[model samples]
Target chain A: MFNKDNQLEKFKDAETIIGASIKVKGNFQGQGSIIIEGSLEGSLKTDANLFIGDRAKVTANIESKDAIVNGEVRGNIKSKNYLAIGGTAKIFGDIQYGEISVAKGAIINGQLMMLSEEHKRNDKLKPEEKAVATDK
Target chain B: MHVYIYDDYLNKSKYNKTINRIEIRLTDLGLNGKIIRLGGIKNIKGTIQNEIKLGAKTIVAVGNNQTINKIIGAVIDTDIYSDFQKKTILGIIPVGGDNSIAASFGIKNEEEACNILLARRVEKIDLGIVGQYYFLNQATIQSLGTILEIDDYSLEIIKRGEVSIINLLSDKNQSIKSNPHDGKLDIYIKTKRKDQTYLSAKKLLITNPNNKLLVDGVIEMATPIEVGISKDRVNVIVGKDRMFE
Candidate 1:
């Protein structure tokens, strides 16, 4: 019984934290949650949640279980579970999410799509069926 | 069984007492194995190959992290032992300077290590591979401002410091809870500028011009390295309070 606020709070104990002054350019994939307060330019995918701090500037495609963004992102974002755009957030890319919440002052300049039920159902199927559907 | 003793520590006159104690403990534990004193770094591969040819099922390293690192390098480079590498069990005694690997397995001293060997409890652990080398603990680079790549993402370090790829999470200050068996490498970047430091990734590729890479705090190698998890590559004797458990 955890709300979005509670879930976001859980990321405070992130295993990886990119500091405000650092700049990273690479592909990052992991099982643990990560918090970013710096600048990153690449792709990021994790089995856990991702927390982007207000001072952060990320120019990378992001895929994660959940995401809470309070920064500036210039790339696509796809969250499997939930996506929260904070008050200070400024995003300029398409967003694909299962569920999402946006703060009143947040700015987004691209498409936002809640994952379709058929897409969700397709996601649950095995790789072979998904491949067959793609062929069709 | 074969025991490869790193003679650098054992040959020292100061450690006669410790060496004697380890010898006595090994004998008392009823573990019969051919003990080979490693002569130099160059001879490591040949020694391991010879032992494996002589039907060695278990190879014990009777020194610190350096000794284990050498054995891992030898086992990985030698083709004769490749097929049987996973089957071969590696043991540690922790008699040298940095015994963090042994310490991670709940083995603080030589006596406890011998006892664990007698208990015969083995854990198949994961190894971090950097090109041809296999490391059990972690690999690090000091000079920063290098671009680290992991899959499709890249992390560019802005400052000068150390960037480490950790395999087995040790007692060292690590925010990430990394398990050696978890088919993932923990990447930690620490910079010289105090507030500017801090970054972690699961896996990364080192594409920098830095020449030196330290593995397990020992074994320095040239870079342009690819780091990843080699699943269940090594079997080691561990105590009941081992790290993974």
Candidate 2:
């Protein structure tokens, strides 16, 4: 049997599921990680990592160091380090990151812009994280 | 051995009263005890983090899902991994914030949770991680996401409420629509013209060969979208009757 205490710590590197019945409206900020298996209408700010699950529906903007999407994301997503959209991903917003890899079958309606050389320099050098948005 | 009490009772008087009662209970039981009342929701994370950092063992929580979520987030966020051996048990009182995770775990009620805590037998359960946070309940994205937008505090107030998975499928606007021809984003569509109840119901169960894919939470008009899960990664705590994946 697992210890009821330290259960959270044991899963320091576990995959998460945000089920379909959950809708969160607040700014969700976390560090270690999470997988959105449900719906989110607010902002997702995480410095650790994120996995947008296949069944997830996110209307909120996302900020992460790394992300993998096999789900549907309607808002903008900004990753400082890495980002990937699975073939099943249906992304409707802009994506800004240092490195991005999209699989062949992904559907993205939003614009895609690689980080500018100066922006990359500024991003890496900046002490705190920065937000990226496509206003147009 | 110090027993730390983490409760969400914001009212100072009530909070103090509850802690005093617990302290009396502990003293009667002949255990070294100290009652630390967790304040309002916002202060919860910081308090738990501080307690764990100070090498406090045995966290006795006194609230529901919202409180648990905050504590879990802080525990992971602060990266207090080194204190696991000392902070080895979680005692919960199923109060406030709907207590969904508590109910699901069969903690029964606040009294039962307290009893279990006093008994102090450790159990392991499944824990879900999203990015860095740890979650005990299942995560959803699309159809269920819509439901989450409804009233939270009110919905939580209900001891029990169930959403029909069947109802979600029967609703045409929410179900599969059409399978677009694209390899990148796999789409599956299921729709039917309104007909007699029996006929429409039967058709609903049948998969639509062509339906647009709702990837994650967005509609996938393209061919195939990717998806996967690491089933082996989740770890959590549960009673002996619990079944883990």
Candidate 3:
């Protein structure tokens, strides 16, 4: 069997592009992995990985399953499992996640919070509540 | 039906051509009978309000993002939000360096956008309310926010006008932390580090544990923030094939 972290395995998933010099102003909701290379002026919600490139300038509240930012973000960010910030990142927002990684030089002038068991349990309750509403 | 054109794009000739082309296409569609030409700012300084008051049905924005912004501002300034919404359908021509909001909504070119507008199926899109302005895109703050204010002169001087977001922060970056404007906002901190590669490279797992920080782009606030989704704020004319997905 091949190693998962190997270079060949890395190519199996190519990052999707939002393109450079582009500007978006809306509610950005999606699934699957996405990489922002341009400017985003809105909110982002996703169930998959989201990567903000160093060249990107994002001004949106982001929610994702996993997120790695190496650019400039001016909003709150949320991830369930992982959130990594590169040295080049200039972020001014809040974040919530289970795991966090910050390189030497990353700039974040917001809040950070790790979800406690109670909070995660509450997060679970939200969907159940939604389900009950939909049932009715 | 009057069409007011605004040309504030970097390329003036291209925008003009798009306008002429649109006029030609409308004429071809036998809409010449309803087409009325007006000066770019003829409706400005209190005239558009009169037309809108008379119940204008369609407002076509023929320039770039700023043109759309100006129209939105005028409508809001005139205290005609509901009136504009009830009687108006906005049509945008993506004429600028980057039309992110337009692109995200699947508005590709001037021709396709015009076709959709003429076809007329109103789709209510969300808008982002930042400060006093209602924007259709995301509002940025902090480092990215500061960069937006960089003057054009500085931009031109720094490598013949080729500047990226990261390049602007290189010289002046510091361990500057911002104080929370309101107690409700989560204050996240990423203490300055010196590593070349990211923490993802080291295979060392780090967890925020506090549930109070906004990491990477994740926000966890104990109290409600001023920011949230605003629904059905702007009316758009989208094609039938366009997918909301």
Q: Against the true structure, whose DockQ is highest?
A: 1
Ranking by lDDT: 1, 3, 2
Interface RMSD of 3: 13.1
Candidate 2 docking class: incorrect
As a whole number from 0 to 100, the lDDT of residue A51 in candidate 1 is: 88
lDDT of 2 at A85: 78
What candidate 3 gets wrong by more than 4 Å, as runs, is A1-136, B8-16, B31-45, B142-229, B240-243
Give per-residue CA lDDT, model 2, range B1-245, as digits (tens): 45455654534465566545655655666644555665544566666667777766676556666656655556653467446433545656665446656655556565456556666655443343323334454332222112221212101011122222121111223322211111111112111221100100101111112333232122233212212222222122333322221
Model 2 off-target regions past 4 Å?
Answer: A1-136, B10-23, B40-46, B85-87, B141-245
As for DockQ, the candidate ahead, 1 or 3, is 1
The order of the candidates by DockQ, greatest first, is 1, 3, 2
TM-score of 3: 0.42
DockQ, all candidates in order: 0.50, 0.02, 0.05
Tell me the whole-model lDDT of each prediction, alpha carbons only. Answer: 0.76, 0.49, 0.52
TM-score of chain B of 2: 0.52
Worst 10 residues of 2 chain A by lDDT: A1-10
Using lDDT as the measure, the top candidate is 1
